[model samples]
Target: MPSLTDSHTFSLPSSCSFLISVTDTNPISLAALRSTHFYLLGEGSNSIFVDDFEGVVVQNKIKGLESDDLNDVIMLRVGAGENWHDLITTCLKNHWYGMENLALIPGSVGAAPIQNIGAYGLEVSTFIESVEFIELETGAKHKIKSNECRFGYRDSIFKNDLAGKVLITHVNFVLPKSNYMETSYGELANLNAPTPEKIFNTVIGIRRKKLPDPRQWGNAGSFFKNPIIDKSLLTQIQHEYPDIPFFCISKTLVKVPAAWLIDKLGFKGKVLGGVQCHPHQPLVLVNIGSATGKDVLEFARLIMSRVKEKFNIELEPEVRLIGRNGLIEL
Candidate 1:
């Protein structure tokens, strides 16, 4: 379910299909695993397993959704494996605010912080109070605050040194109880309504119409993180390509749209073998029919190289690469 690209003919490892619990997820028994090395961040939206490796793939089937409503805020605690969108829709159905800007992000709540999944004009970290994860080495559970997670533009500690070392079991977020929405990015700027529900539906509707349904096609959403550049480089690019869209990330860092750069470089909808850039959203890569992990990674590297050569901005992938080292070439 990773959103990188579609793949029906992938040569994946048999471990990917193994499940300790598929019918009712109660954390799989340690005895059942028999000392199998495994790692998990999020499922379905932000990452890919690459190949079917020797390690076991333990699906976090933990499930629950609850909210404590107060005057202007609602604190939500959700299971790690619960479908993120389903939980979002439930929150909206209960008239919860805050998360409206984050509608349609894929994967489990446990996996959200690894990359601080964001869309439209907001990222999940905006509301995250804390993240709960199980330490694999200690066999203990711990909670870390939002700031402690070291959240950045599409990054967090979970995806770095802490990656593959813990199993995220739960996540807590404090959302608004009243109208709260921020429409500052791209298409969202066109929104005029002030209601939180309007903002939520607008984002959800847009994503539903724009991104392909994972059930129908394989993909990991946007493959590459929008490049962050310095002010001088931004000014230089602005002069050369007036239409290049960018936003100031900090006094020293400005975020540039990698998709725009890729499309402008004439890579949009281009296909090679079994992989191709998404036609509708050039930022995404598609498996087309039966693509391999290597095919997609090689194509992605080409785009990254081109972006670096042309703009001097080093592009980084947001998707987590699982399995072996040679799975993809940088």
Candidate 2:
């Protein structure tokens, strides 16, 4: 077994039987795949490996880009192995409009659909046309339209019924040829006149100021998902804390920022062993040198317990935790 300490942003100590990097999708065979059970590993941005994995880890590296321009839309078929930030930069350079709000998301393209990655006021699901994946169990290729992806806040079909059964190979996005901008988020709400470059630059600037660069401070960006609660519950909380901010997801539901709740609980800058709740962004947990996976988990539990006790809301981790057996749900 080999230690995968550097593979994850958490810098957690873990191992696997073997690690294979698949560059291109050509010539894939079941005989080679079925010899050992495996887990698809992306850029390791959204994972926290709590323990050594006993099975193999497949690093998806498939890469390329193809475009078909229509009357008002450009359909882009992107290789899953490509860096997400690189894709956004390319789209901006080519005058693509839809991906500006999602700039600087740290992960590979293959992992985007799995988590339905999003930022600011836009989600990948909004621009996705379709997805192409290879079924690992049978070595069969399949395509599913974006509408069938079952997308939700930081969720998709890949995390549910199709989990561990397939590996995404490509994602096709339908981007607009003209003006279509999203700046509903508070930071971008006041932009005078936003272009693809302007929105992309704004998002990058905000993220840089808020999130610590993973290179300098090891962290999985936004450790917890924003909790969506019933509108009735939001009203109840609002009575006590009138300034509580939230976004209306539907008539019956409201999404509240987990960072606000954690900050309210006073966990920012708090440390447990080598792990600390980020000083600025309470939702992010950082490894302050010499932190182990267990250390990070303990710190997370502390935050969750306090938030639950105070707000009666359970915070769910956005980062996927990989254990010795398989995916571990906290």
Candidate 3:
């Protein structure tokens, strides 16, 4: 483990660089981070950096996972840098049931709120009871309630106002009590999954088979956030596309499959330089060997532009583009 004083920076995906400084697990380190010359603090996982970074990048390395039974619900208090998938399996092994559907989504536990990471029939926000953060200005750790989180589809206040400040220290989750679960995701629909363990293994299996691991491939899963369309507009989309898969989230907002849009628009498996859209799931952008941040940024922009022209509705990226280099805000 690197000591609190040591901070380093390295080139990743080219054209993108973050000045890594601070390994502070102690209160003093966090206080120092609050006053860091560079305000941006990021944890484990890759975020495509923008062009220039004038701020320091800090990664939260606090570690712990503990649970308490609250009669009807079990709450899990997980550390920020906890390996996400490992945490999923750990929940299953302990007989916790709500998070099984969310297995294999990349990034860390701290990021789950920022993206509201979800799959199958589960979203992290629904399970999130609260989040604790070291406020950037105050350097004081304060717990924020779920409603105050300002969560939306693949978005939260963390991405907006707290964009470069608060470092998540702990996340609290409320999980299901009994056997009730949801495995009705398109891939899981036909398969009969009777038990929690079976569901956990099956979900992990599906993710492994469909999505390339970021560890080996150097890619983030599902580069685009599935567009949420109004029901009337969704009807128009369905009529035009017909075969597109969708799920209803509210009376007006329906979640549309980004993979279907990318594949249908013919961007799937298309490679431009070292970057390529994943063959199996078009929404996933891959870094083949040493693709630079510029390559991925341009490809994603092209995809968004194409999707917008084809569908008349713009698609948005789920990943964050730090600095200001690699982003198409349309």
Candidate 4:
């Protein structure tokens, strides 16, 4: 058995029967591994192993970044295993404009589409042209256009219909050369004459201030998705707490910050065993030290129960929790 604590950001104590790192897309080799239980992993920023896995853990290390410069747009084919924040840094260095708003987000390029990773009012789905992947069962290669991915707020087909059935090989992105800054969200709105480089630096600064460094404190950023609720419910909550912050999604739907709700309930810096809810950003749950999977599950459940009882909104976990067999719902 091999220790998995160092593999994932949460740093929970666990091990797997086998740990394999795939640097290339070898269909035959991957297909053969399908005979046993296995979990696909990238940089392991968004996943936490809650217990000793009964089977193999396949780490995706497939790396490459190829670019095609079209006069108005730059087309990039990024390997699934490539670090996401590093890609954003490279884009900024090359004067690629659109991804600047998404700087400092952890995880791999492959995981980006699954979550439709977003920040500062910009989403990765906006620039994604298509996704290339290999079917684990049949060992056949396939490509799907971005529109067909069913991208939603913190969701996509990779997380639902195609999850656990395929392994991402590369992500195709098309970034326009034209300068269009997204300064509508939070601190970005305060930037004076913001450029891509400026936006990148600002976003990084905001995240650093709000989010804890995973190296110093074990954490998966934004443990829960901001719960989307009906306008009627938002009105009711607002009546009770006039300043309950929310983002209007549509005429009927609104996204209420999970952090606000948790913080209101006095869960900020709350601890259960060795796990603690982050004080600065209540959306994050951190492993203070020597935290076990049981502690994380219990602490999360407590928060979920309290939020539901008070707000009548169900909070869904953004982080994937892996148990002995596979992903478990909170």
* Model 1 C-alpha lDDT per residue in residues 1-330, reported as the tens digit of each score: 233222221222213434343223234454344356654434646556576544555567777777787777888888887878787888878877777777777777777777788887788899899988777666667899998999988889987778767777778989866545687776778877667777777887888887777665667788888988888988898798887888887879878888898998899889976777878788888666677766766788899899889888888887756654312335
lDDT agreement with native, every candidate: 0.71, 0.88, 0.72, 0.93
- Positional deviation of residue 295's Cα in model 4 after best superposition, in angstroms: 0.3
What is the lDDT for 196 in model 2? 72
For model 3 the local lDDT of residue 317 reads: 76
TM-score against truth, every candidate: 0.88, 0.97, 0.87, 0.99
- lDDT by residue for model 4 (166-249), tens: 999999999988857889988888889888888999989999999999999999999999999999999999888999888989
How far off is residue 279 in model 1, in Å?
1.3
Would you list the rank order by TM-score, best first?
4, 2, 1, 3
Model 1 segments more than 4 A misplaced: 1-18, 21-35, 325-329
**How large is the C-alpha RMSD of every model relative to the true structure?**
3.5, 1.3, 3.8, 0.8
Query: Compared with the true structure, what per-residue lDDT tens digits does model 3 show for residues 1-330?
Result: 222111211124322134443444456666655555553434434365534544455665667899998888898999887777888888888878778888877667887887778888777898899998877677677899999899977778888887766788889998869647776776667667457776777888888988887656656677788898888877787787777788888878888888988899888889987788898988788768767657766888898888888887688777656554323353
TM-score of 2: 0.97
lDDT of model number 4: 0.93
Between candidates 2 and 4, the one scoring higher on lDDT is: 4
Task: Sum up the clashes in candidate 1.
Answer: 9
Please report, as a residue range, the 10-residue window in candidate 3 with the lowest summed lDDT: 1-10
lDDT of 2 at 286: 90
